[model samples]
Target: MSVAAAWARCDERVVARQTLITFVGLRDPYAHDPHEDGRHKGPILTLLDERSFDRVILLGRPHRADHSERTRQALKELHPKLSVQVIGLELADATHHPEILAKLRVVLARIRRDGPDDEWSVSLISGTPEMHACWVLLAVAGELGAKLLNFRRTVHNGIAGPRFVRELGWGEPLASLRPETLALLSTRRDRWDDVDQQGAAHTPPRHYFSRAILELAVNLSRHLAPLLVKGEPGTQKHLFASLVHQFSNRASGPLLIFNCATVPADLFETVLLGEEGDGGDGKLRQADGGTLVLIKAQELPAPLLARLLKAVDDGHYFRARGRTPVKVNVRLILTTERDFEEEVRLGHLPVEIWRRLRTALITLPPLRERPGDVLRLAKDELERLNRTLPRPKRFSPAALAKLESHRWPSNVSELRRVIEHAVLTAEEPAIQPEDLDFELAVNLANVFTAAVPRLREGFSMMDYLRAMKLELVRGALRKTGGNQSKAARLLGLTPQAVSQILRQTEARE
Candidate 1:
């Protein structure tokens, strides 16, 4: 081939390579702008000498399209073996960080439609401060796999030129952050608040945790470390697990939930491992590149818990009929109602697993502890239920008063059930106190209050008291599921004492 033909072929290769997403700055189009340091050759012009890009994607305000065009023309005339493209980005205001970030995201999303994020490098030194900050944020968030670059004026021995900085990121600074400080910073970020909404993205969203634990959850989400959430039965542990998933780097991945208490013993292995013997797809595979939440994990046998902890420890698992080990990138989150420490003390939970998870533990506060959350949850639940209704219903002052005054012993779950039932069955448009049917708890004091009206004429005080004691003991035994020690604690007696009382009561019956 002739010299010109060979040169054209080489230029075509350079033009075909995709790279470099940047902005045309306010000072980017000028032939020469003087600074105290030296004569400015424009940011994009300086980048040419520092780095080689196949193409330059220039984003700027609509009025500033001329700047990008000027930069493109000058680069094409000056450099023969380069490719460049100009993208006119319309922004309401360059100084508005949120708007600039949003607009850039739209453009990048479209650009990525043609290719992946790794295809281009974003220039943090281009455009306005908002654009620069957005690029840094996107890089830190792992929104793209593309490398970052910046050109800055530098001097060595009084000789000045633009210096290239490669792969601009938060690595060094983030690594230097103390654990506590990192958690504090994570909590202050609004991402948690953004995902805290429960249903339909309503106002007064439900937070998965209280103040301290929320911070911890946010911090834990930044990495792939195992997480354990503890709470009572109705404390919304599943939603808490969702919070962890949404906040993680794997937010785009699947979130699979496995209920430890609901799965039958025979199916547990298959459900967890897909097919234990045949290499069938399991929950682990289904949840790969995302999160797998084990709900009510305390019900899992100690041996099984050991197996899970081992698998999560190294991100590797073995199916019974598998030829080799299966490796998956999954974030494991376990939600349990049992006080894990007590479970460990009783040998119900494996000591090894407990020791490993203790440092990663976070507890959800019960609804009773958060008095203000009761009304909010009730309203939120009501609104969710009313979505399908022709006319939306609001809480009446009297009904709201009753709800606020009552103690929500079962937490958010119980409130949800009550609100749902009321919405479905209530006759009036406005839910009233009478419309709500609280699941009245059976306690000694409450039982006594209810029994007062049932007393017979001339009922002896001593006999009444004796009968009440027996009833309380039996109730405790029933509530404890015939566990004498648990019943004894409820009745303020020793296990042996409880046994004696049970025997006496049986004989009398």
Candidate 2:
């Protein structure tokens, strides 16, 4: 049935017996002066007149105690049999969005404890935009199971709204959490940007993709689907798996991690599935009501893979060396070092296992593919490593260039190692190019030499020569650890000229 149709058929008799909880905005368009003593026809009053509520709880700022008390008295006078109470909400300013969100969460928690047997509805029309936003977030996050009330110009009973009752519109769990994540990040957006400005200018888009992956993680967490995370080793598949567990509603449950590649092939099955005569629970049994994370899933033997497929498909499996079936519930999160699809096609991995486990798939791109992330991640890692040092350190301009240039073969793990080494060994406050140690060199100079003239319109021979000279200067600075004196010495020019060239480069940037 359509959502509107479902709400339209709501049992009115049942809702009448419940308490009506709502926020009272500081400004009420329809409210009358208290001393004037005319019947107040505000939205809250309108709602009270139409619906038979058992009691009404009005939440607002403590400073508005008089306004709330008058509202409570008016409510009691209109419906003498009705119970009414006024509660003060701390920090009701719209600019304090996080605190307001926290207050809303607290209110919902109290409602959860006190109104389990009562039908509930929340009004979205009475508060500030920020409060409305918080209310919608709560409803969308499935934290507020209350029916939502809104005002419409046209009345359904010639009285108001087939009142826009809210339906949980966020389709996947990830979709719901995406807004919450954005909200959290939104609160501290300026702080993160300041971190970049104070030290190294970070590539902002790099973190955006991480947020996108978090959206996918939220969806994966809702089911018992066998998740297959495919990425190069050290691309953070394991960390992503942990995030999946952290964001999941099952976060309170256990997370059992076992590396398939580390276990002996003969002991793999027994270790994962557990033997009946074992002293304690095996990996599978231990992970019950929680998550089981398998690292290097590509290394599982064919027999063990077959047994895993059976257990996953049937939701029950017989213990090794025993016939008794053991029922289990585990959200399987698997990380693989190889392309899972290609392995299945080559018959290295069983198709049944692949088909069963492919319910949710997340592929993390290698560091080379996401070059923009290099410096941002490097800066963060460097900052973390410098915390224990005698003094915090930073990277030189040339060293930052080299950090961005080198194609990290081991992804973030390699980056962390390099940063740690630089922090510990460098004598200067700023790490120089010579302080970095990585093998892979991507020669942007050669590429720029061949392409700059062709890529730029109306280019001349002199422009090409200037570009070449610029590349040479950069190469010299990189070699000399960003020391202008050394670069000028290598190029047979004054240090002033090299400094001028570097200034021009910064201006263009």
Candidate 3:
């Protein structure tokens, strides 16, 4: 006997929030099952019409992917506005739950990480029983946070079609899960798990591959203009150079970094441009059709800097003791810590280069300015360290909060050290707040008490107060890599106040 779906109000109603993810089964491509009366509108296409989905993911097994493309094409044709994707995986054994779970977790994690706020649903009508079981587990564990859906095929009032049912009947809470199973779920990859590998943390990417961050700097790459990247010690200038080089059209070519601070200006011509015969083949030729990053470019003498610019503009340079001009197509990316404003005041910087620097500059801010990125970086670092441990380490909420709250004075370099120290020093698998060791920049109370044991007769109160304020401002700026905003925050003052203090100090100087 055939019965009606009972719910007829949704016959034409469409669900607003929709992202449907399901597997491509053997019968998915067929619009109708000829042998079955009610399933005339076959499983997938029929379910799609009955359900609501703006985006669709058709997960296909390696062996059964013959109809994946056809299904995708058909779905696109039917629903022109729908976003469809067919992802082929290597899960050959349809009955193996573990393999299916692992592969599905990776795919789902990627989707979730990319758009954590997007509303999505999982269909259990298409895949094998084992696959359905995995989906249930995922949804129950809160890994999904997805709506559970199933399609019911039946004949109702002489109409044979599919009906989409949403309620799956809630399962027991996570507390009922075994301690070990709960632990496994806790370790599941979250959105922050994929923190950019080559960020301000200075993790180097493989020379052969390009790892571009979603940054303003990425937009400047692939251009032929001279680029200037300026920041304090740990503000990711080196990493930015790598990012630009890898993403550039000359990525296939070599990337050569020459530090001006390490080598003297006398050797800039020979070392960078190279010398002939006994001298050596310079980086200019070596980095032909690639990128050459000059670290601490301000250290180059005025005369050497002029010659370098001429070579860059003319696309050729003379090697020391060589008659022939060495022609090369290399992108110039210069990094520096020198305060260009101060150089401008001193009149040590050339006008054209200074203008170029101002126009094509990439300023990397200190870590304290990026509050949202701090925990993501810290959690990523923690996970990386856990791979080497006997048992995986987890951080308490307090510990994580502590890491997030710290104004990272020394930037990413300091973050790396702190995380490393905590991971190794932590005795238990769970790291507590006390386990974190921060190298604070100032100790005002202690310093004040120690420095001024007693006030001398000639010590003026106003002068003493001014001196204290100056030292505090100077210390905050130093700790925060000359970042006025971070220095102001540290001093419990506004940026304008900090600027006024700095101006007063400069006047005194």
Q: State which candidate has the highest lDDT.
A: 3
Better of 2 and 3 by lDDT: 3
lDDT of 3 by residue, 176-208 (tens): 554333322222211111122211222242211
lDDT of 2 by residue, 250-366 (tens): 655777777886788888877888888753557888888777888888888877877776676688998877888899877788898788778888988777777777767888888
Give the alpha carbon lDDT tens digit for every residue of 1-509 in model 1.
99999999998766545588888876675435466666566667766767777677777677877787878888888777776767778777876667776887788888887655336777765565556656655655567556767543332222332354545444444544444434333322322112223221211223434545555556888877678899876787887777666656676577777778778776766777665555477787788888889888877777767766677777888765565687877888899888989988887776788888887888888888888767877876776556546777778899999888877777776676566556654568999887676752323435633635466789798767667777777876665567776566545566888788778778878
Q: Which pairs of residues collide in model 3?
A: none
- Model 3 has an lDDT value of 0.68
CA lDDT of each prediction against the hidden true structure: 0.67, 0.66, 0.68
Residue pairs clashing in model 2 are 155-160
Cα lDDT, model 1, residue 23: 83
Off by over 4 Å in 3: 1-213, 440-509
TM-score of each: 0.49, 0.51, 0.48
